[model samples]
Target: MVEDYRTHPNLAKIKIVLVETSHPGNIGAVARAMKNMGLSQLVLVNPKEFPSQVASVRASGAADVLNDAQVVASLDDAIADCQVVVGASARMRKVSWPQLDVRQTAQLAMETVSADAQAQVAILFGREDSGLSNAEMDKCHYLAHIPTNPTYSSLNIAAAVQVFVYEFLMATDIKSVHQAEGYRHQLASAEQLEGFYDHLYQALQDIAFLDPSKNARFMRRMRRLFNRSQLDVKEIDILRGILTAAQRQSNQLKTLTQDRD
Candidate 1:
């Protein structure tokens, strides 16, 4: 039996995240789209306008989902608890992160949630005007791309979310996908990753490997790499310990060099 998306232990963990959305009506439409399927979780990051009359009117019968939506100040805050993050963008970038279509992404999300009930997956949609900035997308594990007509190929935020949400529900309904293979350990959350990345950046700078602050592209690639690895909590701790040791040794060497000079 298909459990309700709102209450399904694992399905409920999936969240739809929006970044810098401008139009309140679009938000309402998106809420309506989400409710069309069984999905209910919605997170808005720095929305221009929320609780607007325009949005409430557009939400129609989906007022419940709209009312329950979580609003946050930043993308990091919105997805702090999410273990898996997918950014849905119409543009294609053959860069660090692997690109997958909506169907594939939906399948991946389902598999991850099935593996661990407590694990959360966040599907992110960018702003209406410029889409997600590079810095914003740097935080994603995969780029969920939608192939559209070459002629006037832009999609409204609500429409895009609708397509992704529909595919997500279809992925769940078609067949019974078991929890990810060997899904024993819990994956690291976005918050933990942010902290680990900070530690790693400090360690690299300590040894003069490369200033992570100056090397935005390199750090993005690094994020993509570790994000792809799906590092668990223990793995993060191990890496942090290694980096701490390296930093200490690097500091000691620097002090000796200064003494010699």
Candidate 2:
């Protein structure tokens, strides 16, 4: 009874994010894979190599995908407007996160777009050697892992993307869910979240809760918590206001200390 996702209007809202990619050919291959699955949105974050003829040769006839691809400086920029973000990683970290198999991840991503007409989904694939880092994974609501031979389980970034994209198309059920009229307000974007993080860090520094020189583990954990909460625009504003007030108070306390000294 469900309509084909290939023809679904929301299908266009899905975005593929590649972070710190090394090889140009993988970029081209990813483009080809996306095109094969009727996906067009492609974002590259700090790729080591791009605009190479090797990529063009690999892309074959799917050069249009490469031509239209967005090159960004950071993952935050790439996924700024997306309502949902999923990161693909095979490595397990010390801290546990909500994990999903490729199939469920695809289903969840498709269902998000189906629920809200304005919703955009981002599936993040990381660098060839390391995949996503702990800091990067904190930005994702869920971690998707592709099941492979545990003995030898590495998958190429482009091939992994194709597998997930294919799952998305097959998992989607377009007929059951009706798109909502609109979201009450747009969800806080990754860009906005980055701004919030900067503000929070400054506030923490002002109060001496965090040292500027040392890279702390707590920050990553905090990011994981906030990302899972899915804060909206209003919530972000309130938090920013709180941080500003805290900064002001910290400044006044510092002034008193300096005078006493």
- Candidate 2 matches the true fold with a TM-score of 0.83
lDDT of 1 at 202: 79
Residue pairs with colliding backbones in model 1 are none
Clashes in model 2: which pairs? none
Candidate 2 runs further than 4 Å off: 174-183, 211-215, 255-261
Say which candidate scores most in TM-score: 1
lDDT of 2: 0.82
The TM-score between candidate 1 and the true structure equals 0.92
lDDT per model vs. reference: 0.86, 0.82
Write candidate 1's Cα lDDT for 1-261 as tens digits: 444566555556779999989999999999999999878899999999998899999999999999999999999999999889999987886565778889988888877777666789999998899889888888898998888899989999899998998878777743324342444777899999999999988788778899546677778878988998989889999999999999899889989999999
| Model 1 residue 16 CA deviation in Å | 0.9
Pick the lDDT winner: 1
